[model samples]
Target: MVAGDGQGKNIHDLPDEIILDVFSFFSFNELIDILQNVCVRWKRLAHDPVLWCDKEYIVRGRAQNGRSCCGVTCSECAHCRCEKTDREVLRTAGMMPQLWTLTMMRGTRARILRKICRNCPNLTTLQLHGCQKMNYSLLKYIFEKCPKIEKLIIANNLLADRQYTELVSCLEHLQSLEVFENRRGAGPVLLRFLADTCSKLREINLSCDYHPLEDVEYFVKAKRDTLTSATVRWTMAGKRCVVPVLKEAASSLKKLQLRLFDVALEEEAATFADLGELHNLRELHCNQLCPHRPRLISLAFQPGCLPLLQKLDLPHATDLPDDAVVTISRGCPSLRHLSLTFATSLTDGALAEIHRLKHLQILDLSGCSGLGGSAVAHVAQLPALRTLLLQYIDDLTDLQPSLRHVLDLKQLRCLDILYSGHIRAVPFEEFSVRLVNFRELHVTYEEEDEVFYKNVLLRCRVKCLGSG
Candidate 1:
C-alpha cells in the first residue's frame, strides 16, 4: 500500500480536466509565473489547450514605451515590455490548437501572431488595438485561419484599400466590428463590404479615419434588417463627407453616434430629421452635434414615433427650449434614463417637467453652465433621481447646507457638483442631519470648505435620520 501511494504521488495527483480547471482561474501572467517555478509536468499541464481556450491579450505602455508600444514605430526597449516580451513566452503559448478568442495589440510581433494563428484554428473573437506593424499578409492570414470570427476589433494601420476589401470580404460571419483610426483603409470600401457580406451584423464601431457619406449610406441600407447600433467618429475631413450619408441613412437606424469637429448644429440636426422614422429605435446618442431642440419639440409633444424609447443621451444638445422639455415629458412618459449634458437651454421650468419622469434613474447635466442654484434646487427635489452630474455650472446661490430635507431623494446613489461655484456656507452642526444613505459623492469644494458637505453628512449619519 505504501509503495502504491508513493507511485501515485510521483504521477499527476489530479485528473487532466481538474488540473485545467485549476489553471483557468489564474491569469496568463500568473500562469507564466507558475511556469517559471513549477516542474516539467506542471508546466506541460499549465500549457494545456483548455487553459489557453480564451486568449485575452492586454496592451499596455503608450507614451513611455514606444516605437512598437503606441504608434507605428517599432524600436525595442528592454525596459519597456509591450507584447513582444520574449521568445519563450510566445513558444509556450503557441501550443493551443483550438483558440476561441485572440485579443492582442498590433504592437505584438508578427512571428508571435503567426504562431498563435497556426495553433488556434477555431478562433472566434479577434481584437487588435494600435497594431501599426501588422501588414496585409498578417490580416490575410487571420482571415483565412479564423473564418468563424463573430466579433473583430482591428485598430492597426496596415490594411490599404485593396487589402481592406479583401480582408473584410472574408469575415462574412462577423456580428460586431470595431476599426480604429490606426488602420489605413477606405471607410467606404469597408462599409460596402459589410453591406454586401455581413448580413447578421448588428453593432459596428467604425471609428476609423472618415469615409465618404455615400459609403455610410450603402452600409446602413445593407444592414437595415439587423443593424441597431453604430458608432462613427470621423476625422475632420471625414465629418463633412459622412453627414450627407447619415442624412440619407438615418431613417432606419435605432442607435447612432457621431464625433464632430467644427460641424454646425443645423447640419447635424438634419442627420436626425429622418430619425423619427426609426420606429424601433430605443436609444440615441450625439456626442458633439448641436441637439435638435426644435425637433425635440415635435418628437416630444406630438405622437410621431419612438414609442419604445428607453434611453436618450444628447450631450451637445445645448438649446433645449422649455417648450421642448415639456413636449418630451408629456410625450415620452416611458423614458427610463436621460442624459442632457451641456444643455444650456434647459431652464427651471424644465425641472418641473423632469419631475414627471417617474422612471428616470440617471440624469447627467454636466457642462450645462446655464443651470444655476434654482435649477439645482429643483433637481434635488426629484424623487426618482439616482445619479446626477452637475459639473461646470458657475452661478450657485446661498442654500442652507442642510439641503437633504428639501430634496427628499433617499434613492440617491451618486451626486456630482464639481466646479458649480461657491455653495453658501451653513452651520456644520445645524445642517439638516439626515441618515446619509449615499454610496458615492463628488464635491468640487476644498477640504476646508467641505465642512458643509462631508462633516454634515458624517454627523447626520450618526443620528440615523435618513437611513434607508
Candidate 2:
C-alpha cells in the first residue's frame, strides 16, 4: 500500500523531521537502550539534540556490576551507572544544549548529576525520582548550578532535614515545585521559603503530611490566576477552608487533586462545597473521600458546567447515585477519561448518560455493584473507547451478552473484569478466535483452563491476566 505516485512508495523513507518527532516520544532509556540499536539511521535519529530538549525526557540510571565499561559499544556500555560510564553518558547528553525538562531515576548516582549540572545552563525543569540517600548538599549543588531551574519534582527519595542556602536563593525564579516527601524533605523550611518568595509559582504539589493548611491557602491566594495546578494533602476541615480561596483563580486552575487526610470524612459532610465554580478545569481527582450518602445527591455539577474538563476521578464516592453521574455527563461533556471506581449506587441509566461523553476513551467503574451486563452494551456504543475496567462487579452476570456487545467497540484494547465471579471457562473457549484488537483481558479462571489459556490466549493476540 503505497501512494499513487511511484516516487513516494516506501513508508521506510519517511522524512527526517517526521522521524525525529517520533523518536522524541521515546523515553531517554528507550532512546539509548532500544532506538540506538535499531539501525544506523534510527541510531542517528535517536541522537538528535532537538528531540531530547524541552521535554520530560527521563534519564534512568541503571545498576552496573560496580565496574567500568571496557570501552566496547555493546550492552551495559555506558547505559549502566559506573563511574566512568556515568561521565560518558553525561558528556553525550551535554550535546543537547538548552535542555529544559529532565527526570533522573532512583539509584542513579548523585555524583553523575553533580558532573552535569553545570552544563545545564538553560535547564528549567528537573525531577529526581527515588535517587537513594539524597541529602541537602546534593540538592543545593543542583540549585546553585542550574540557576534557571523553574520546576523541581523530587519523589520517592530520602531527604532528611538539613539547611541549604542555595534552595532559598534560587527559589526566586521558581514557577513549579513538587516534593513527595519520604523522610523530612518538604518540612517547614521549604514551605516558609515558598510562602515568602516564588511569586511567579504556578504549580505546587507537596503531597506530604508536613504541608500545613495555611501554606495551601497562601499559595492559592498569592499566585491566584498564575496557579494552574495544585496537588496537596488536606484534612476535611482544611478542604472546606480552601474552597473559598479556590474560587479566586477558578478560571485559571486546570488540574486539582485533593487527597483527604486518612480519617473518617463523615464528620465534614454537612458542610462541603461541590466545586461547580471550576468551569475551566481540565482534570479533578478526589482521593479517599467518602462523604455522606445524602450529600451525594446535592453534588453541584450543573449541565454544561465543566465544558473544558477532560478527566474526573472520584474513586471513593461510595454511594454516588445515577442523577449525580448524569449531571457529570451533562456538565463534563468533554471528558475523555472518567473514573467512579466505587460508586455502588449507579445503575444502567448512568451508563446511558455516560455514552453522551462522545470523546471518552478510558472508563473505570470497577466496583459499581448496580451495573449489569446490559451496561456493557451501553458503553460499547462509545466510538473512541480504548480501555474499560469493570472489576469486582458480580452483578455483571450476563457474560455471553457482554462479550458480544463489546465487539462493537472497534478501538477497545483492554477489558478488565478481574473479580466477576459469574465468568466461567466454557464461554471463553471460543473467545480466543472471536476477539478483535483485544490486547489485554483480565478474568478470573480455574486451574483447568490455565494450560489451555497459556497456549490459546496467545493466538487471541492478548495478554491474559488472572489465569493462575
Candidate 3:
C-alpha cells in the first residue's frame, strides 16, 4: 500500500527526552545490549547526558537465609555482570557532560571518578557505601566540579588527609553530609571549616557516638540559633565523656542523640530542663547504659519540653515506671513514631495508654518480654500504625489469637516478629488473604518449619529466620 512506513524508523525517530525516558526503564545489561547494536541514530540518542545521568545500575544477587557455601561473592556472580555494568558506566561518563546522581559501591578506581566528574559537571547526590581504592584526588575532583551538591554520603573510611581537607574546604555548600569513619585526627580542621564556611549545612553525623558540644562550636558561632539537626557520639559503651559538651550543643539542637552516653542517667536529668528550650525539636534518641526508669519518665513528662517531639527512641530503658507510658501518650499529642526496645519494665498498662497517640505510625517493642497478646491487642486499635515490630516476647505463642484483632490496622504494611523464641509456624494463609494489602510480613520459625511458611503462605513475602 503506502510502503508500510518501514518499522517506524526504529528508536531513532523519537525525541531525545522520550528516548531517554524509555531507556530509564531498561536494566543496565539491557542498555549495554542496545548499545552494542550498530545503529547510527540509536547510538547518537544513547549518548544523551540525561539517559546516562538518570540511570542507576545496581548489581544484586540472591541472598540466602543462613550461611551457605556459595555466599554473596562477586566471584559467583552471573556471566559478564560486573563487566557489562562497568562498560556502560565508562561509556556514559566518557560521552555525557550533564550526568548526575552517581552511586557505585563496588570496585571504583580514581581514574573512573576523574572521568565521571570531567564529563558530568552537574553530578549530585553521591553515595559511596563501601567503595575501596578511592583516594584524595578522586574526591577533590568530584567536589571541585559539583560545588552545589545537596547530599554527600561517604559511608566507608577510605580517605587520605588531602581528600578530607579538600572535601570540607570546597564542599561548603553541602546541605546533608554523613561520614561513618572515626576521623578524630581531621576533626578539628574539618569542624572549624564547617563552622566558619558551612553555615547553610543542616544535618551532620560524624561519629556513631555523640560528639561533644565544643566540637560543634561553629554551629553556635556561625549560625547561632538557626541550627536544626545534629548527632554526636558523646560516649562509647565502656568509655564515658563529660556532659558539658553535649549540654551546650543541645541548647539550639532540634534533633539530638546520646547513642553511647550511658553513665549520665542521673546526673544529666536536669538537662531535661535544657530540652524544654528546644521548641522546634522533633526527634530524640537517648540510650543510657544504666537505665533509670524514673529519670526517663521525668524527662518524658517534662513540662512543655516534648510538645513538638514526633519521634522518641528509648531502647534498653528499664527506668520507665508504670504511669510513664500513659503520661507520654497524654503529653505529646503529635508523637507519631515510638520505639521501646529492651525495656523490661514495660507492661500491658503502658501499652494501654499507647492507643491515645492518634498519629502513631511505627511501634517497636523488640525486647519487652512481659508483653502478651493483650498488649498487641491494644496496639492493634491504633488507626494510623503502619509498621509493628515485636521481638523476644516469649509470652506471644499464638499468632491467630493476636493477628485476628490486629488485622483491623488497615494501613499496616509491615509486621516483623524476629527471634521471638516461642513463635511457632502457623498457617498464615487466612491472614494473608484477609490482609491482601500487606507488603511485608516477617515471622520467625524453627529451621525445619521455614520451608512451610516460605511456600505455603500466599500473597505473603515471608522471611523465616532462626528463632532459638
Local distance difference test values of all predictions, in order: 0.59, 0.65, 0.61
Q: Quick one: best lDDT, which candidate?
A: 2
Model 3: per-residue lDDT, tens digit, 66-184? Answer: 21122333333221123325455577565444445555555466676667667666666666645345566666667787766766767424332435755655676677666666344
Can you give the lDDT of residue 204 in candidate 1?
79
TM-score preference between candidates 1 and 2, better one: 2
- Candidate 1 C-alpha error for residue 168, in Å: 3.0
Q: What 10-residue stretch in candidate 2 is worst by lDDT? A: 65-74
Tens-digit per-residue lDDT, 1-468, candidate 1: 122464557335667786677667775555656553677777777667676554443333344443432333333221122344536437655544545656564356777666767766677777675744666787788778778888887653433365665676677788877767763553343567667776777787876544666666777767666677777763333445354444444455667666653444555444444445555566766565444344433443344556666788777766666666666666666677788788787766776666766777778877766554456556665677777776666644433333333346657666666666654431234334432455555556655554456556653332111111
Q: Say what the RMSD of model 3 is.
A: 6.4
Leading candidate by TM-score: 3
* lDDT-superior candidate, 1 or 2: 2
Per-prediction tally of clashes = 3, 1, 12
TM-scores for every candidate against the unseen true structure: 0.68, 0.70, 0.72
